[model samples]
Target: MSLRFAEEIILLALDDQSGKLRPLPDRALELAVAGGLLMELAFANRIDTDQKQLTILDRSPTGDTVLDSVLQTLPEGDTSTIRQAISRVAADAPDFKDKILKSLVEKGILNREEHRFFFVLKERRYPMVDDREEKEVISRIRDVVIDGAIPDPKDVVLICLMNACDLSSAVFSDDELEQHSDRINQVARMDFIGQALAKAIAEIQEAILETISYMGM
Candidate 1:
């Protein structure tokens, strides 16, 4: 089976040489993973969303365990806006992130390692055993953003998610990103779901920043 968007985000966040996750701002990776899950559901036709609300179109399992579990829990209604759905999923992000990581390990795409800090603290890091999937994801994005190739909706969503999570630097150098920034923004706006996800991520990030500023005062 293909890797889900959440799985892909985790893979992209891994440092190739260190076999450790890159340092990201608070809640960046988690919210991206959460948005990824919801994005996957949207593409699976199990759910749909518009500017005002997210609706559950079908509750039937996608046969993907993690997604099925999430889908099953989404209350049947268009009551929640897309942002609300993201917040709900992101609340359990650390747990769901683990689930996606383990799934990648089971697929033999990554190897999990443990290190003991001072023989008391345990740190788990994943090193890639196979990078084929990661390469494919990067390639598709580059093609669309750099070569001006028509983007698949999934690729467009990937672009938006990476930018939303501030993971763009992980995928491109500052120069390349600057040069192609327009294309990146263009592709990112192609999908309504991607647009909503980015907007929601921005609002949440802003709220956190505001809270931190208030606390500092």
Candidate 2:
């Protein structure tokens, strides 16, 4: 079984050989991952959202540690809008990225190794233990953007994450991005459950950036 959402976001943001996160606009990755987390929770039927707010549908555990941890923290009642939920989760989840990496390692998708950059700076690296999953993800995106197949809703969500994190360049070449830019934009805005999850994500991403700017991230 695949771990969706944030795990895929981390997978995209990570350095394939080093396991370190790539330099992005600081906090953008976390914010995007938070949006992914909320979407996954919504899909799991543990939460639901509208243009206005997100509400808990079930409090039962999802049996995944990272998901459960964030689920535990979402405020009760319907006061939290999707953007608010995204911001809160992003703010609270300082370790969810590490947890996602550990989950991938446990799944044998990656191998954890210790290395030093300067003979003094020790760091943990996660090289590929299984490259197939990575390839499958890339293939799905290509199928939508390049082949013009109608995207799976999950693929649309992944594209939304990539946009939120400024990660299109990580996966697509300059020419491909240029040529398929319109299709990518169209797919990322696809609808979910009669609401636009892509719009929700894009709105949340902007809200996060505004907060980050005001707070000096």
Candidate 3:
């Protein structure tokens, strides 16, 4: 099962794809948490019609350039109905709560305890981590993508080599994949990233020395 909180944490950092390696968006992550809470509340039938309507607009738009572009491309709809829905939700906070509560209860993922409620899955619950910690992880991933400091060069070379030779072997195991990934992050920083990638490709089966083939190629 997916960890709802973990998904929320990575939303914002996914926005900038300019980097060779992209990071998740922080705001998107927060929006996901909020959305999960909303989902929890809705399943509990604590949401009102109005609250649900408002929530649609509040959703995180990160990693959604295509969606956003599509939305903008859509022709305008009638505004009065949308406005009326907003007004109705604003008028009844209790109804909103009821709707959310009912929805959550219906989903069987939330349970009421006295007045308060709790999510069923432990993974859904998370304490907020500070920006510093988040930034550190992001930075490390970026460094790996840009610098080519992957812990194991052999695995990276093998993948590229396989591609060059048009050979289909057993897939890289998860651990080997992660090592190649680490190198990808580091390689993102290299001026000769393209060349390095080429070298990786050239290192596949060859009559000449592998390293020399990569160099000459």
Which candidate order results from sorting by lDDT in descending order?
1, 2, 3
Top candidate (TM-score): 1
Over 4 Å off, model 3: 1-84, 115-217
In candidate 2, which residue ranges exceed 4 Å CA deviation? 116-121, 192-217
What C-alpha lDDT values do all the predictions have? 0.87, 0.77, 0.31
**Number of clashing pairs, model 2?**
0
Per-residue CA lDDT of model 1 for 1-217, tens digit only, reads 5878898899889998888889998899989999899999999998887775788888887988889878755655655877778888888888899998899999999999988878875888899999999999899889898889999878888899998998988789999998999888888889997888889988898898999899999
Taking all chains together, each candidate's TM-score versus the true structure is 0.94, 0.85, 0.19
Model 3 lDDT per residue over 156-189, tens place? 3222322222221122345645656545433432
Candidate 1 deviant stretches above 4 angstroms:
117-121
Residue 112 lDDT (model 1): 90
